[model samples]
Target: MHDQNFTSLPDLHGVPVFYPHGTQLIWISSNGEITRPSRETLAAEFALGVVLLCHRRWSAARAAIDIDHYLDVMELFAFVRPARFVLPTPSGLAQQLGLARPQQGEDMAALLPQIAFILLDELASTPDPARTEAGRIATMMTAGGWKWGPYILAHLGLPQPLAGPPDSRYAAIWDRLADYTDYTPQAEPGTQPILPDAARQRLAEMLGENAELRLPQADYAAAVAASFDRPDAGPNPAMVLAEAGTGTGKTLGYLAPATLWAEKNGETVWISTYTRTLQHQIANELTRLYPEAEAHESKVVIRKGRENYLCLLNLEEALAQMPGRPRQAAALGLMVRWAGATRDGDLTGASFPAWLMDLFGRSQTNGPCRPARRMYSCSLPAL
Candidate 1:
């Protein structure tokens, strides 16, 4: 996580940049001269990230920041310094640079920063007014009392915008910026019948071009049909246990009938699965079965576990307690990026490291985190 997100990274005790994971820097002069530091060390990398995103304040404190997206800083930093480099890897620098992972013992960490220096030096602009920001930013680094003050003060300078408009998001900072929703829970179970045969026929028709009904799937569909046909349509719903193995097309087997039944009866069926991933998978299939018009009306919706979301309240508390906690720092970096990008707040398909899970588990709750009080309250209503 790298793109300039953490002016929030606690300005620790007059030390402008103190990163946990390894980070290194390459100092470039206004005249485009390059100075190589010890690329083997983490000391320069984190500081480099700080200087890259440092907002000039004619004073020590940075300009007031507006955090609009979930870890915009992480994206920024990643763009400059991919975490895959600093973090230990068997492939090392070669892999991080998209080169073939070599078997030789060349120190990748040592080499990467130097290579990075070469690239930046080549790209560095001529010493001129456009680079005034870079010079001012390099000055800010020296003003922070870094051990490498003389080097940064001499070499680095230029406040060029790292990204164009495509990479930036304004901090409109919506609190309850959720979908406009108005729904009422049904008071009783819907016992009315939807034509199972009609739904079954529809499924067959839709898949007719490429798919044919398998014997096991057809049998499963027939059993579903029998359950609905039961004479004893009482308040106590009938239970149907099914057994099918892989390649059985069981999803379609049950979906064909269930779609018909729900359509016929105008009822919502709660489909449960062992994992949230599977839950979304089923929801996607339901969408394919139904048209967009009906799908939006609760015909298919994913009801995830409480943990699968970004909690702003928890995030604030965590940031407050972030000093001296490196794992939380790393996890927060990932969370910040996730917050900005994910649409439904679903953690599905996201890669969560152990630290992130530890952090998320601390904030997760079965119900609303708290009774609705403020915008950042525990409850995040799904739309």
Candidate 2:
């Protein structure tokens, strides 16, 4: 299959074909004619057991392609689906795997050999642990025999059957972090006082070799450091209104002192962002302070509203309706896989692809359950 050259639509009748742009499905006929099939014809062909392959399933579905039969190569490999901004086309996958991308305007049919080789290579190279997990999830969703199961088994080899239904007990683990009783408050001032030079030095250290000491950034850090001075404030609170133009390193400037103060005082410092994008940016910037992945997970946290995370109850409800909803079941199955591997329960800005919600017709992260709401009501201390 990897060495075969495809010249016509009949050659790819039952074979997986790569289509990068998802807005429309194109076919190259035997006479070298490009044709776009109607959604009805596409559905009929799928109903008659025609198999199509694509990078992202959601894109094909949007183009009226049947979601039940088509194989999503990206989801098959990634396990955790990638964001939409990252294209999962043959070229995109090749680039990610450090292989050469298909040339521009290259024949789509001729690219079949390369695509087959890429998929086979990726499957062969996948770690056993990941393949096992992916197979288990796929088996659970397909129930050992469904439309996509045979294809997966024939092409990629069958994975182990699921041990049983996934344990829902693991779902509430996020709620356990809200135990404020375990938190101990800091009563006295920290032993090490935060000064402008010290904060600037910390910032420099955090930036490493990329550190470009800006005078304004140091001054900003100095101003923010003064906020910790109880003696200076006396009976009132100290407020610093800083105004800086774009491109000034204000985030690192303030973070230096804030992190230092938190560490020395053994306190939690809450840094709020107006937008989710900025929140993610701040989280990314913390990598400089905590370079190790596990240490960063333990140190810095991104807390959002209850609506941003998944509700286990809602997921159970969605799963219960899986009878006539193959698409919904597939989406939920993917989410279940993601839940197991997610760093936090956050479904919005994390690795959980936004397109999955679109597949199921609604966002899973909205409308928290009562228990989830109550859990979010309590104060969560930083780890």
Candidate number achieving the greatest lDDT relative to the actual structure: 2
Compute each candidate's TM-score over C-alphas: 0.48, 0.70
| TM-score, candidate number 2 | 0.70
- What is the lDDT, from 0 to 100, of the residue 272 in candidate 2? 79
> What is the lDDT of every predicted structure here?
0.41, 0.57
Clashes of each: 23, 0
lDDT of 1 by residue, 237-349 (tens): 66678878898777777777776766666666666778766766676666666658555534565666545544555554554454434234433433544443444444443
Where does candidate 1 have its weakest 10-residue lDDT segment? 53-62
Error of 1 at 356 (Å): 7.5
Write the residue-wise lDDT of candidate 2 on 1-383 in tens digits. 12122232133334544353444565433344445667676566556543445444554555555445555555544443333233545566556655666664235433544555565455446687666655555555654233343334334466433324433322222333433332346686554557777788888887897767788887888888876665554677665677787878899888988898888887677987789888878888889999899988878888887676656556766665555454444566666666555555566764666545544544543365345332332233442
